[model samples]
Target: MPVFFRKIISPSLSPNTESDDVWEAVRAFLKPRSWQRGSAIDEIEHWFKDYYDASAAVSFDSGRSALYAILEAFGIGLGDDVLVQAFTCVAVPNSIRWAGATPVYVDIDKRFNIDPKDLEKKITKQSKAIIVQHTFGIPAAMDAILTIARKHNLIVIEDCAHSLGATYHNRTVGSLGDAAFFSFGRDKVLSSVWGGMAIISQKSPPKADQPMAEKVKSPPAGEAGQKLRQIQEKLPYPSRIWIVQQLFHPIAFAVILPLYNLIIGKVILECLKRLGLLSKPVNDQELRGEKPLFMPRRYPNALARLLMRQLVKLKRYTIKRRRTVAYYQEVFQSRNEIIMPKSIPGGVYLRFPILVQNQEEVMMRAKRAGILLGNWYTSVIDPVQVNRENVGYIAGSCPKAEIYARHIINLPTLISEDEARRVVAMV
Candidate 1:
């Protein structure tokens, strides 16, 4: 699948088709056998249940939708608040708002996850839950965060957007919280182009009277199971048109990236965006804190198949990412101009980040050298595309987050070893 993705990105890449069935993958990509809900969805759910040792796993159109479902299932709404860190995606807070709850922004620690001190300080009578985001797949200080959650009686929802197969103290992240959500967006830890799943923890299930989502081959049985099932029933499948738009992404990219330097690719990409044949990861409305009409829908089976294929390579991807991270740490230890992030045995460096003195100049230099570096959370709300006030983020509310946003630059961990060294040399 990785080989196929590279080939689809640009034909200029070596024609090494040794391990990949390029034509088979192409046929599967262009024409999936099942466009409607099928056994694939159940198969994925079962896979997650086994992988995380969870009771139930429900699929959704996107991570936000899965989060929304979890919020509604937990009955967190109206007069409630959800505590989340500032150095994160807009979707986290957006999901909180959509649940009729307020998102209270908290400062972050050096590790980039929420600081337990600020988290405890942010708690109020109305604070119902705490969304602990595992930034860049680095496990947050789970022991400390869980201690605070228990003291405040707050539910912890692990935002596993950047963390699939990530662990906290020898336990998997998704299984450590009350409930957790995973994103399978194009650039997330796993890519299905557009997909997500909500898993309810079985380790510490709620009281007997509470909802229990435990159904093997059939619909889940208890209140939680029935509630989520009902939510899915009310939702509709992604429109065929939108599905085609997703399908166009790779085909469009394959033609564009190779020709990018010649200037033709730039025009083609912009034209495709204007023609609505390509979709941005986040649309204009999302940055403004408004949900798109197209979203909050059910996960499509076609995308589920894509996700299943990615599942096959999960082990290899994790191994390569860790190896790359080790190499980065080894080379960067002697450097003084930059501050490297902490390296741990279980953390997955989705994109390795380091704090630099001048982020803008570093990015400019990389661009000049013909290297494209990752720029996530360029601002507290991310991509420099979000409007902070619209998302209810006060400028000075989280000082540490703001500082990280300004100085942090990321190195890609999801590329070839050759590519990794090349990027390191350029930086």
Candidate 2:
């Protein structure tokens, strides 16, 4: 018999969601006036501007949309090549493609970040920028990457989808690069079910403790300000129906999470999905490198309200994530079968990545044990379902990413050490 689903650790669901957040979503769905339109958009923008130490923070429908806007803002297109590492989400590459720029693949190092050496090797005259992903909340080697980027006069766009509240060398991940984008997707560091933002750091942002009145009302001057306004104007406002559908996520899971076994909960979840209520984190068109029809829109105000609630708990979440990684490191220190990532200061450690033999078997066992061991970057691109050629990922290009994909299983960080021990023993 299939095992009962006791818990899920994957970033996709809101295991970290509080009861209040679900209740808030319920309120928003029922009260259209609360979510139909509001000032939450500007408030969230100010919050990101403050958080990322950026001159401007622009909201978008998804992280990819933010990235796309950043690319567009910089006028990267056609023959331009944006250097990006392998073993990342398809959304990263999709954004580049959406802007008509090619994503030149680079390999990752022991830290699961872009190898500066390979990054330099792949650079060409067409290389306009380097998209450095803080892979799984672990900061990439920004010192080396920035040096390389400067040497070539390339813009550095930090992909902070997994690295919110994560830091490197005392600087936040998003602030390290020329620009950065964040995901508030169900699976990201924070969850509003579906949201994202872009932070352009061309100029020094307002002071760390800048007043909100000064921050939101005052956008950066000159080119940066113009770019942000341009992107915002081009974006379509999110559909009200879509907004409610995403809001339904937390509500559905509030009940579903408690009853989700291999039987009943699974059936209800599938039924709701078939009914087009719960949106998949990744769309099918994205796997094939095609843009979703509903994309390139501005993030909704209602969802921003949800994100605001999460922002209030950012510090608490960061501590838990880092502590969980430390716990994993301590346990794996004596183990010989699994290879732990190198320890680095300031890394938030979104998911503790480990390489092991028989990755499939390990995950299968974890599933049966009622522990949902996350499989991030299951393929060089992600989800193991993407069309490699369509996504521009050539076979045998990044061998490390491929090997890591075969063996990597990410342990959850939001869990307690006692629960982590249960997860660790399964490995």
Candidate 3:
């Protein structure tokens, strides 16, 4: 029998740091002059460049856009192949396609990062670059990966979306690769609702042909929606779960969950947009067909302001997250059933992911206990129901990634100690 959760104790519901400070910044910047054409964006880019020791840093509307820009800047398009891990967000591959390049799927190792050995095997004559994702803030084997990239003369682009503060052998992740991109999406280590940064370690490329900017010129709907969702989290857990549960069919769990996100959730988001709320909810569908590949857009002034405020407290947040990971490590060390990855040196723990049999049952049990378990990368290409052919992922090519995708579940690091204990007990 499956255990069903009545209450939700979600890490996704964790409060942002220095909320009062952030709100104050938001209030002060209410006027158009405050955000529009201000120095905040420049300040943020410099901050990231200095923090990561990069030669330059550029901000964008989203991480995917940042990556697309990198590929475009490097002239990696049509007939070029970019190597990427199979166990990752669809956005990773989508960025490649957006740049008119093909994404070659590679397998992941135990740390949920690209396997250098497998990476070397997939490099064909058309391979132009490698996007090494530091999965879940766990750094990949940079030494091995860099070696492989150097051997093949491929440009290395680090996907630092999951690893803002993470380091590899005393070096920050963004600085290790030739170029790297970081996301400031709602659930990332640092959240500004929706923003991204691209850092360059080498010489900049000549500007590419720019696409005419799309004219959806109202205030960013995605930012407004993120604020509304943050307010929604303040509601009691039961109420939150009830509201989400209402959107899905009663038999949702039995069917593929991403399907619900694609069909029903898309409608709800459109309704929210019509209501004058700019809610750009995350979609689970794979990128297909030819789309206009445009140069990365500038970061919004408002989001840059919010991100600046959050940056002040980033060190504290990193410390707290590491402490939470330590707690989980101590508690779960002896458990035979739960398989936690070995600790990576200089790694900043994001969600504490573990491999287990009967992952669905475990997640259900956790939810019933009011624990909000993370369901990250539940498939090799993530949100697995998407058309594999569209993204160039062969279903049976990466056997290990397929297996890990089936068994991996993540414990939230944003919960309280007591809640963490309860989660451990329940699981």
Ranking by lDDT: 2, 1, 3
- Model 1 over residues 49-68: C-alpha lDDT tens digits? 89988767889988999999
Could you give me the TM-score of model 1 versus the true structure? 0.89
RMSD of 3: 11.1
Model 3 scores a C-alpha lDDT of: 0.69
What value of lDDT does candidate 1 attain over all alpha carbons? 0.76
Candidate 2 local Cα displacement, residue 89, angstroms: 0.7
Per-residue accuracy of model 3 over 212-264 as CA lDDT, tens digit each: 25111112223322322232233222122221222221122213222222455
Q: Which stretches of candidate 2 lie over 4 Å from their true place?
A: 1-5, 34-36, 202-222
Residue 279 C-alpha lDDT in model 1: 67
* Predictions in order: lDDT: 0.76, 0.83, 0.69
Where is model 3 more than 4 Å wrong at Cα? 1-8, 13-18, 21-29, 202-278, 284-296
Query: Using Cα atoms with residue i matched to residue i, what is each candidate's TM-score against the true structure?
Result: 0.89, 0.93, 0.79
Give candidate 1 regions above 4 Å deviation.
1-33, 204-222
Better of 1 and 3 by TM-score: 1
Q: Give lDDT for model 2.
A: 0.83
Top TM-score prediction, candidate number: 2
Candidate 2 structure quality by residue, lDDT tens digits, 1-427: 2346465445445766878899888777777876746798889999888877677798888898999988887777898888999999999999999999999999999988999999999988788889999998899999998887766667788999998888788887888877899998887788898888988885632322344442212233246646966887777788888898989998898877666654677688889999998988889999999998878888887898888888888889889988888888888999899898889888877788899988999989987777777888789898788998998989999998889899899888887767787887888
Clashes of each: 0, 1, 2
